[model samples]
Target: MRVAVYYPWVYLRSGIERALIEIKRRSRHEIRIYTNHFDPRGTFPELDGMGVTELSRVSVERTYSAVTAAALSIVRTRLDPAEHDAVLVCCDGLGPLLTFANRRKPVVNLCFTPLRATYDEVYRDRLLARGGPARPVKRAAETVFRLVDRMAWRNFDEVICIADTVRRRVADNRLFPESKIHLAYPGVEPRLAVPEGASEPMFLLPGRIMWTKNIELAIDGFRRFLRDAPPALQRFRLHIAGMVDAKSRPYFAQLQELAGGDERIVFETVVSDERMRALYTQAWAVLAPAFNEDFGLTPVEAMAHGRPVLACNRGGLRETVLDGVTGLLVEPEPAAFAAGLRRIAQDADLARQLGAQGPARAAAFTWPRFVQTIDAVLDGAQRRSV
Candidate 1:
């Protein structure tokens, strides 16, 4: 089957782009990507050969004006039904708008979470806390977007979420029926076995450097950990590494400012896959402080590297990181994370135990399994259309 996968933007080596790359490489169907913006230099190099088509020239900006323009472009753009048997939307933001013009073909949504601003109360609260003249305007716009977003959901034959957390969000929001929503966990590449050596007294925070990551929480927690930790753990470092996009540069800068001349807090941007693996291999444990992430790939990736994960007890992290088992899951607060970090740092045996169980658990999520689940969903959609 020929499949056209639509995502709003393909300009970051984040989980969504990585998932698309894995699907294109592993799926049996002929897959082609469609997006509003495609930047070869910024995203995964593998995408260069994936036959990605840009529907319109849209700059990668997170401002309201830019998002509105991109949504309009997607709604107006049409895909020829003859070119593909079905459509798969890599729904993150406005990508579902593509279904407006391509309803002629069966549409399946691989939802990363129904737009966070509209569906996520935590995220909405944060935005509202930054009270401004635009608050009323933002609320009015969201009301309309929510209506349009739910309307677009009517076109999706099935919704495949990355986690049960997201499945519940979609169902609770009434964006799609709970019965039609399926969960397919994303896969992480297995890292080559690194010899068991003493890990550095370092905690790694890895993923796209975005505001929603709540990286400041990690920084604050690390600082708190350092103040009360044993002298031996005082030498511990916090490394923030990941892709930095245009819009997120400000947020990244804020994080740097939050670090405040502390050489212990290092920042590495747009790191190569090889470097990321090295960071994971050297770290004592990985940190995930993102606010209700759809389905965190960093934790699974860390587990694959036999590195324990210290993640917030929210969203998809709960599904992946088992507290006191695979890794510790604490509140998304600096004090809570500081306590969790202290425990992992002080008890080497506990850390080792958690890391030991990681590989086996990570092995359950495979690229082939993810693609096969998607393949079955696509086939089922096609059958219903027939």
Candidate 2:
């Protein structure tokens, strides 16, 4: 069957883009992507040859006007029902608005999470705390958006959540009944066997560089770790690697400032897949500091490389990382992470023990498995429609 997948932006090497690439490569069905923005040079090179259509010229700006414009365009756009057997929406934002115009086919939504600005109380509180004079305006907009978002969700035949964290958020919002929602975890690629050797004294933080990533916590924690760690551990370095988009340049700059010209804290932006894999293999551990991530791919990727993870003990990380087993799960504060780093660094045997169990734990999540689940969901939706 032919499926049209709608996503708002395809400009970053994000988990959503990775999922799209894997689905297209592994699924039996023909998958064509429809998006408001597409930047081949900025995202995965694998997307170059895939079937992708740009719905409109939309800038990836976070300003209210730009966001509102994109939302209007998405809701107004329509797809030809004759061209596709089903519609699959990859939604974290206004991408769900596609349901407003395309309900003729079997519509399935692959939700990462409900919009954090509206549905996530913690995130909404953070926004309001920093909202200044526009707090009232922001609150009003959120109320209106929640109504529209719920309406869009009602049009979908089914909603596939990437993690139970996301499933809970959707269910708690009353956007969809339990029967319409399903859970399908995303997958990671298997890494080649690394020759047994001492890992480099490095902690790698990998993902898109955005405010939501909470990168400052990692940087601050690393600094605190270095201040009192042993001489051998003091030599350890922290590397931050990921895609940096136009909207997140300011956040990236802020992170650089927080690093304060420290040589041990390095920033590498828009790294290649090969380089990313190499980083994972060489590092002593991986860092995941995001607050309540929908379902983090970094921790799983780290585990696939036989590397331990130092992650915030919240959200999907709780599901993926078993504290004191596969990796150390700690509070999001700098002090907590600093202590975690010291513990891993001081005990070589402990680190090795954690890393040894990683590959086996990671083997359960594979691209083939993820694609099979998606294909089955699409097929089921189509059969019900007929």
Candidate 3:
């Protein structure tokens, strides 16, 4: 099958890029891609190593204008005249344009969640929870995205959600027949080895430093966990890794000041994949306490390295981490996180058992499985089109 995956933008450093690479690797289908972001500066290093045929390379003008222009271009040039077997809208933002452009082809939405619900579940409260005077602007942006999201959902022939929890939201939107929608979770690239015999207790946090990531909560929990631990056991280190979003610079500064030259905490921003693998390998556990994490990549990647994760009990994290098995799941509160940390810290055997189970679990979600599912979906859709 020849499929076109259409997306509004591209960020080379993200999980989406990894998923694309994996799909490209595993699929027998001919895969072509379309994107609105074209950086002549060679910004997307990941794209350098891939074999993707680009349909158009125009830059987006502004928020509303970009969507309009992208939509127009898709309708005009991207899809060959009845050429694609299927069109996979990579995210909610591209759905409107793809649906309008390729009415002759089946359009499948590969989404993490319903965009409208995502705004309500995570972003809305997150802004108000942390935004202070910027709350009104945040709320208005949510409203705009909500309307755009709903329109996009209604237009797609099928929508693929990453978590079971998101299935309810897709159903509520009445987007497609129940059978047409699929719950296709993301998978991690397999790691060949796990680091052994760590002398010191080390914990890792990976992802952007945005308010939604709730790194502040993770930091607070770390502080509280030490307070409740014995002095000898409180010498553990927390490695916070990932690029800091510009919007989060102030918050990051504040967090650094709070750490105040404490030897127990280290902050690393924008590290390479090799460095990330090292962090996961050496760490005692990975922590992600964010709410509605929407198919968290870090936890699964950590699990792939045979490292136990201590994560929030809700959202996509719930689906990724098998509670009491792969890792301990706790509520998002600081005390709960503190307790989870302490539990894993005290039990080396239990941690080892969980860590050992991780690779097997992650193996089931290989890139081949992901692409096979999509190929089957697209094949069926093409048959229907004929």
Instruction: Give the Cα lDDT of each candidate.
Output: 0.88, 0.88, 0.72
> For candidate 1, which ten residues in a row score worst on lDDT?
189-198
Error of 1 at 164 (Å): 0.8
TM-score of 3: 0.86
- Residue 340, model 1: lDDT of 93
What TM-scores do the predictions have? 0.97, 0.97, 0.86
Task: List runs of model 1 lying over 4 Å from the truth.
Answer: 190-198
The worst-scoring run of ten residues by lDDT in candidate 2 lies at 189-198
Per-residue lDDT for 155-245 in model 3, tens only? Answer: 6766677667666656755545566678777776555334344524998998777666778778888888888998766868899998765
lDDT of 1 by residue, 1-386 (tens): 99999898898898899999999999999999988889999999999998899887786776789888878888998988999999999987787888888999899999988888888888888877765888987898899999898888898998999899899988989988898788899976544322234679899999999889999999999999998988899989999999888778888888989999899999999699989988988999999998788889888888888888999999889998888888999999999999999999999999999988888788777677788999999999999999
RMSD of each: 1.4, 1.4, 3.3
